[model samples]
Target: MALRIVSADERLSAAGAKTTMAIFGPSGVGKTSLLKSLPPAETLCIDLEAGMKSVQDWPGDSIPVRTFADALDIGCLVGGVNPSADPSGFFSEAHYQHLRESYPDLVQMIAGKRIIFVDSITDLTRQAMAWAKTRPEAFSDKTGKPDTRGAYGLLAREVIGLLKHLQHAQAKTVIFVGILERVTDEFNRTTWQPQMEGGKAGRELPGIVDQVITMSLFARDGDGWRHEPERGEDRRLVCRAGNPWGLPAKDRSGRLDVTEPPDLGALLSKINATRKG
Candidate 1:
């Protein structure tokens, strides 16, 4: 194979490609509710967490994923209607083959849309971990239990693989919702971060997406409690666009407000405007 080189102009032209954003926060922080505001006609949500109850009143298209197989089948369009293999046995060769075959279809599906959202990457990680535990290869014969180290390694690979697939899809934008996890450092200070099941995925996640936003609650003096992005008198959900208070975040577009209401459409519009300028 010969080395290929691209011109600076070509590279700069591709720099304006669409973005993928990851949003994470504590439960009840309105992560799911934020999706309701996205343009329903242009967005499709894969509800892996089955937490659409928050957006039940919102008119949009969503698919609830019950099992790991169900999630893969929906996202990748493989493994038929009902998979006979145990969900925990996802590491099997057959499952890998199915994943390989379905990737092209997944790319096609994402290419046909402007926005593809996955509700709760944390829950997806949980599903992957659960599957890893059931794999006999990850179990310790001496203890008759799954080996923690082995299981976590498998979980990380599975979660990262799926995330990589979504990241590389042809959709104009991709959004991953996740829960927040509180971690205590050596200084005894607790900081919130994305709740990725395996430590590896949590570390790798921020590098894959163009943005990492944290949805949080804010209190305004005597206003009791309100969302971080609330601008009016009433409390509403909001997002922290860039890194704040040790939270992992990035605003590649550099046009988003540090704290703004959770509106995907507005975010995209601002990015597009910036690109045009």
Candidate 2:
């Protein structure tokens, strides 16, 4: 086949299209609840951290991924079991090829959904690292530890690859839930970042997602410092959509408020409106 050239206008348009979002927050900060509030008919939740306990009453469909195998099952990538049965064997070349081939099926399953939520990526990375540690090639008996560099490298690649696949999938929205972690840089200033493992994934994830939001609480004076809110109460869940107070955030739509209600559906509407204008 001869090579063909196409103009920018011929390329796929991002405006008014599905968004890729990464939302991070402390435990019990309403991250899962906010996602559950989106249109249930068009949403599918992939629960990795048992986060559905709070939103158990939500009407949307949810798939609980207690193990990496469960995640693979959802993608229909569970090929023949490794004879050696090594936990890390799933990442072997043959198995990886199976995953690549079956990935389109997973995308097809999500094609009609407007939102595909993965809650949370932090746990997914943990599972990835744990799987890496089981690989003899990636761990050293002499050191009595996994090869930190190689293990995390594998994790970074696996995570980034899966996210990129979902990002380009037919789903209109893909949301990755994560936990918040505090770190101190050389400047001795404390900052918050997503609790995902591997330094590379931490640095790269924000760039891939259309929005990176940090969930927080908004309380009136004298309110106790509690992360969880009471049911039927008005304690607000705050979403910071941009860089502020050293929190990692970005909003490509340019319509999100510095702090707003933690309702993703409303935010998506605003983004669509802005893009149309």
Candidate 3:
């Protein structure tokens, strides 16, 4: 196969560089409210959790993802198909054609949007698991009984494949907003993670995206501790990895401070800024 080397000129054009990020926070942390901070004209939200009440007044478009099938179709619509995938495999060109036939205007619906927003992966995982339970893989061949382990395996493969497909949408930015959960172990040490049904997707998601941000309410003193907002404190987006607090975050662009204002548009602008001399 002949391959042409990409030019440095193309590399420096940040406008063409696509970004995939996951922003996680606890419930009622205004994760959905971040939608208003993005440019409405260039953003489209895939509302999987029915959590648009917070952004109801925002002048942006969103598609309600009520079922697992809708989620898959939308993913395929936005990400396109994997050309190298097996013809009969999931999310192959054959599946793409089926989606096109079903939703003929899907492309036109999101043609002008530069950013594809997913409201919450926590609920998406629930939907995916629900669908996985009905499939043959979720049943044990020996007993023909339901097997949660098999279901989770299928869920992991489907969700990860779907995420990778979205990551390959190289011309548009993709953002997945998810709920963050706090867990304490035997040592009573608290750790944070994305709240999803299956463990595999949450664990592997950080490596798949360009950025892993934690949107949380923190102390104004930069102490890396959560503070009550009722005390008139502020919330910040934790962008960089390795901090006193165990919030999960990473900045691949290397252009962000440890904490940044909770605004999506400004965050994206900073990430896409070109290097200086």
How would you order the candidates by TM-score, starting with the best? 3, 1, 2
True-structure lDDT of candidate 3? 0.87
Report the poorest 10 consecutive residues by lDDT, candidate 1.
76-85
Tell me which residue pairs clash in candidate 1.
Answer: none
Please state the error at residue 142 of candidate 2 in Å.
Answer: 9.9
In angstroms, how far off is 198's CA in candidate 2? 1.8
lDDT of 1: 0.68
Measured by TM-score, how close is model 1 to the native structure? 0.74
Model 1: per-residue Cα lDDT over 1-277, one tens digit each:
3579989766554444457888887776678887777888777788888788878888777777766656655544321212333554543346645665757655455445667788978888888888888877588878887688888988887677666656654435778889877779999998777877878999999888888887776655563443343343432233333344555567776777656666777776676563433
Clashes of 3: 0
| Candidate 2 ranges with C-alpha deviation above 4 Å | 1-14, 72-109, 140-146, 184-188, 219-244, 274-277
lDDT leader: 3
- TM-score-better candidate, 2 vs 3: 3
Instruction: Let me know the TM-score candidate 3 reaches against the reference structure.
Output: 0.94
Task: Write candidate 3's Cα lDDT for 169-258 as tens digits.
Answer: 757899999988888999998788899989899889999999999888866565545544334267789899986576899999999998
In Å, residue 257's CA in model 3 sits off its true spot by 0.4
> What local lDDT does model 1 show for residue 238?
34
